[model samples]
Target: MKRLLLFPVVCLLLQFSYAQSRDEAAVTQAVENLRKAMVDGDKAALEKVSDDKLSYGHSNGNLEDKATFVGNIVSGKSDFVKIDLSGQTITIVGNTAIVRHVLDAETNDGGKPGTVHLRVLLVWAKEGGQWKLLARQAVKEPVK
Candidate 1:
């Protein structure tokens, strides 16, 4: 009798672990999609991956709404020539996923070239069965 109960509990635990791993993979893909969109300046892709009420925070303490974030990329005001992400971690809690990573990027905004290195935190929420970016905050990394 105890063995029978233990079997069900073990199965349920395995099932839940599998589901969480799947969600983590989905959130990882969403983050990759957003990175590509930012580099390509694809307005449609950007809009698709981000929530309607996105709160984007820059390392310099600037904040932008969804429209401004999309528009800046599309208009070349915030251009990402290349982006490399490392040390990424994703944690899922209910319908929300919190992601953190180090972002190193080359930028050419308004015809001036520059580089950016920052630690970024991203919040993604499952909406309509898709993971969409809900919020982001970045802080400059210490000089190395």
Candidate 2:
């Protein structure tokens, strides 16, 4: 009886771990893609990473829709460079995952390199079997 119970417990643990791994990979990749896109200034990449009607709340309290965000990058209004994720935590609960990435980044607006220490909350949803960013809210954490 003890062996049987232990076996089921082990199997259940493996199943849960596997499920979590899948979700983790999907959302982590999405955020990584976004970072790369921002650094490369590739507006086209947003087509896959972001939803059509996405809401973006910036650290500076600016709100921008999908079109505006992409347009700004493509039109030379915004530029990001040397983007590096310092400590990132991604968690998935059902179909929703909140990704927090604290990084050092360089922006054209004369911000400290990665010292921006942005605490970004990225919301991703599974749509048609692929995960895409539905919303993002961020706050600039003070440098410690």
Candidate 3:
């Protein structure tokens, strides 16, 4: 009787782990998509991947809503030359995913060239059968 109970519990744990792995992969892809959209300045992709109620916080303490965030990228106010994300980890809870990563990027905002290194935290939510960025915050990291 003890052995049978343990078997079922182990099987259930394995199944849950597998499901979690799949969710992690999906969230990772979503993060990559967001990076690509930023680098490519693709407004449509950005809008699609981000929720309308998004809260995008910059390292400089500036916060933007969905429309402003999209508008900045679309209007050349925010342009990413190259984005390199590393040390990424994603955790899922119910329909929400929390992602943390180190972001290093070359940027050209309004024709001013610069580079940024940041530690970023992103919150993504499942909506309409897809993952959308619900909120994001970044803190500037000193370059070594």
Candidate 4:
């Protein structure tokens, strides 16, 4: 009797284990679009993904507000390239979500070509039924 009750519960949980939402495919699509936007440096997409009061922390320890962060990309200052990436984990809880993504990026680094393997933690909050990024922090790990 105990095993019979446990089996259905286990199966039900497995069905929704992917993420906090039933529509995980939409979240994946949203993340992919954001990556493309960051790589191509489309200011519009950047703005769409972020909240008005966004806090951005760079891998180099520089911090910028949402406006400054978007402006830098629009002005051609910090550019993204070679954005090879892997599994992105997104967790939605109530009205907030956190996305963890691992990316291998090649950058001009303001005239010096550099490559970095980093994980980005992006905090998102659902405001007016739309997910907006509240904060983003990127940390680089030395790859062997």
Number of the top lDDT candidate: 1
lDDT of 3: 0.96
TM-scores, all candidates, are 0.98, 0.85, 0.95, 0.78
* lDDT at position 96, candidate 4: 73
Is candidate 2 or 3 superior in lDDT? 3
For all predictions, the C-alpha RMSD in Å is 0.7, 2.8, 1.3, 3.6
Candidate 3 per-residue lDDT, tens place, 49-133, comes to: 9999999999999999999999999888999999999999999998999999999999999999999999999999998769999
Judged by lDDT relative to the true structure, which candidate is superior, 2 or 4? 2
- Model 1 Cα lDDT, one tens digit per residue, 1-144: 999999999999999999999999999999999999999999999999999999999999999999999999999999999999999999999999999999999999987999999999999999888999999999999878
lDDT of 2 by residue, 1-144 (tens): 999889989999999999999889978888889888877878789767888888989888999999988887666577786678867888888888888887667677433333366878889988887888899998988767
Preferred candidate (TM-score higher): 1 or 4: 1
How far residue 51's Cα lies from its native spot in candidate 1, in Å, is 0.4
For candidate 3, the 10 contiguous residues with the lowest summed lDDT are 135-144
Of 1 and 4, the candidate ranking higher by lDDT: 1
For model 1, the stretches where C-alpha displacement exceeds 4 angstroms are none
